[model samples]
Target: MNTTDNTPSNIVRNFMTALDSNELDTAANFLADDFVFSGWTPKPLNKQAFLTLLENIKEGIPGLSFNIHNVLEQNTSITGTIQVQGYQTDSFIIPALGTPPIPQTASSVSLPMEEVTYRLHDDLITAMDVEHTTGGGISGLLKQLGIELPLAQ
Candidate 1:
């Protein structure tokens, strides 16, 4: 799907493409002004903050890419599974963990499949939520970088 297309599925495809390509402007154009993003971080993110987080991820992870395996649309919502792969090229803190930025080791990590759900209104994405299907969530991703966290009580 093209970025100009506004259909729910198309918008999701374009948005993910733009994000994987680091095209912040194109990605932002697909979102509503009051868009809310949940997942990746502990707190929800608004449109501007979401864009900034995308930029930070792009900077921290060199060669970042998202491979979409499936997309399903129902009514105004679209859900899909994606595989995210990247190499850590610089020191960066885990937003979800809120720890100090860890030095880069140039380690390559391929996060397990994640499910993303996007809700659209008037052709613009208004809400997005992501969940890990397996691999222990954020901690699993961190494990790939040789960082381990204590198990939850």
Candidate 2:
């Protein structure tokens, strides 16, 4: 690991680490103001909304964890697999996805390592797109919990 303050991989690792550690304030520093995050919801979430989504995930999953691996950087883009595992033991709130919070479903999930791509610009994350497949990201996590969201018709 370069460990340099500005390295894309370093920045991304730090950001995810912060998120998994529930250090949202620290995580926010690594995101550009115009940051966009996808795959967690039907629509893309902006930086603030993305942070809120993480918060909701933490609150919903209680002890959810993130393990980032297989990071490969090419130009301004970084691709990696992030393994997210946890139990849905608490009510989850994601306004962009649904109105009221989802009650605890007493379900557990260990992702097969979702492939994530992060785009960096000027040392801040400009965009993050989680793998658009079953068993990846929040969408997959919800499915694992037996909660099916209404598809875009």
Candidate 3:
């Protein structure tokens, strides 16, 4: 779906394309210097930190692909759901959110996630919030951590 506010959606689409192409530098260029992330690994990541985190994810999954299925836009904000599929080869955690020490890469796990982004002036993404679609996340991950997240459904 498309949003009336085309700018935000355009930015989001461009960013997603960069991610699908594994262009870390290009993706970072679209984010604000002080982008904020909720329910995402490394919450409140500055430009450098966010870039580093993306690099790490790329390292774990060399061929990462992001497929955005829905997009809703209002004013300067845009929200959508994206499906991520890739191969993981290391052990990494999404820091402070979700299960930690997660396997770097696995078979094409289909994770449906919600993403909300606020545009900076009409340009970069100044803030963002991301969350998993499932109410009960991975069994072992939460079981070992002994924590529960609010269900998306």
Best by lDDT: 2
TM-score of each prediction: 0.82, 0.88, 0.67
TM-score, candidate 1, is: 0.82
Query: What is the Cα-based lDDT of residue 19 in candidate 3?
Result: 76
The residue-by-residue lDDT of candidate 1 on 28-141, one tens digit each, is 999999999876555678998888766765667856787875999999989998788888898776454454566788988898788888899999999988774555344565
Write the residue-wise lDDT of candidate 3 on 64-128 in tens digits.
Answer: 66677678778777878765656666555544244345553354444445454455555788876
Mark the regions of model 3 whose C-alpha exceeds 4 Å error after superposition.
Answer: 1-6, 89-106, 135-153
Instruction: Sort the predicted structures by lDDT, highest score first.
Output: 2, 1, 3
The candidate maximizing TM-score is 2
Task: Name the TM-score of candidate 2.
Answer: 0.88
C-alpha RMSD between model 1 and the true structure: 3.2
On lDDT, the stronger of 1 and 3 is: 1
